[model samples]
Target: MKIKDLFKNKEVTLSFEVFPPKTDDGYEAVEKAAARIAELKPDFMSVTYGAGGGTSKNTGNIAADLQDKYGVPVLAHLTCVSSTRDLVREVVKSYREKGIENIMALRGDIPKEGRIAFDYNHATELIYDIKSLDESFCIGGACYPEGHVECERQSEDIIHLKEKVDAGCDFLTTQMFFDNSTLYQFLYRIREKGIEVPVVPGIMPITNKRQVARSVALSGSTIPQKMKIMVDRFADDPEKLKEAGIIYASDQIIDLISNGVSHIHVYSMNKPDIAEGIMRNLSTIIR
Candidate 1:
């Protein structure tokens, strides 16, 4: 099913994301994890693409499995920054053959080695390419609630977002955010700017103390003082930290849904326990 259709449903929507493994040896374990999460029966599940081709091949395989074997609709992520046009086409064509219709198009992170030469400089270019190749595709794009780390200003970031939408993005999934107010403000700004596509907020359940620092460094999502205090208090207790993290993420989702944000996506980290905890918390609310 197209994600846009899922977004249109009256009941709030929830989805989970899982990534392909970096090496072949770990493939079975990751697939097992994906299966466990699928058992939670989220509105849909997304398979993440790796940075390079080696791991990326597994993306299609996993997405296909989720859709065909597990009977869940899949959103297959496609990254274009480090790939040539031909390579991008090949990946998209492979996905189409798998009967996967939804795609999360991304510019992807530049590798540390920094291969400067590229056929696609931005996600908008890739969105345009995907649409040109197959108009039937339901393409989703990524957005930053607190502004992109690379962009100096939130206003500039929204402008780029509008450009991406104009390039044929069907909807957007936000980068994970800790504070709800930041996303609320971003929604107001984007709506005021005339970019009205449905934006699904991404939530990450921080189960580890080290994750707090790493998440901020990666996505620039501000860690609220409340969350900070909780982390500080429970950082030493792994079980406590994990329980608190799941509750915190559930609270974030409840608030978003109460305020009429209908769709949410969780970066499940391929952890079925976290996904199940969140789903159990929302059992009455989402259905």
Candidate 2:
């Protein structure tokens, strides 16, 4: 099913993201974790592509399994920064052969060693390439409510975002944000700019202290004072921190839904328990 179709009914939708393991030896473990999350029966599941397409094969395999074994529609990711145009076509072809209909197109993080290839520079270019290969695939692009780390200004980021949507992206999913107000403001700004696709807010539950620095460093998202206080209070207790984190994310989802944001995607990060915790909290609301 195309992800865009999932949003047409104006019904609330929830989805989870899982990533393939870095090495072959860990493939089975990652697959098992993805399966457990699929069993939660989210509206759909997305499998992330590894940095530089290192785990592209496993990404295809896991996405196929989720769609075939668990009967979950899968959105497989494809990153273009480190890849040649030929490689992008090959991956898109493999996804089609696997019965995957949706793709999250990304430019991916630049390797610490610097960019290895230069076939694509921006995500908009990748979006164009994907559409040229298969117009049937539903493409989702990433947005940042608090602005992307590389882009200095949110307005400039939105301008780039408009190019993606204009190129052929069916919808947009945001980088995770701690404050709902941030998303509200972003939505207003984007709508004013004339980019009107359904934007799904991505929520990452901060279950551990380590995730804070890494997520912020990667996303450039602001850590609101309320979130800071919660982390400080429960950072020491593993179980308490986990529980608090789930509740915090659930509250964010509830607020989004109440304010008419119909679709929410969780950066579940292959943890079935965290995914289950969020689902259990919203059993009645999502249904």
lDDT of model 2 at residue 91? 97
TM-score of 1: 0.98
How well does each candidate superpose onto the true structure, as a TM-score? 0.98, 0.99
| CA lDDT scores, all candidates in order | 0.92, 0.93
List model 2 lDDT by residue over 5-99, tens digit each: 88896499999999999999999899899999999999999999997888999999999999999999899999999999999999999999999
Model 2 TM-score, all chains together: 0.99
Worst 10 residues of 2 by lDDT: 1-10
Q: Which stretches of candidate 1 lie over 4 Å from their true place?
A: none
Q: How far is candidate 1 from the true structure (C-alpha RMSD, Å)?
A: 0.9
Task: Tell me the spans in candidate 2 whose CA falls farther than 4 Å from its real position.
Answer: none
Q: After superposition, how far is residue 173 of candidate 1 from its true place, in Å?
A: 0.5
- Minimum summed lDDT over a 10-residue window in model 1 is located at 48-57
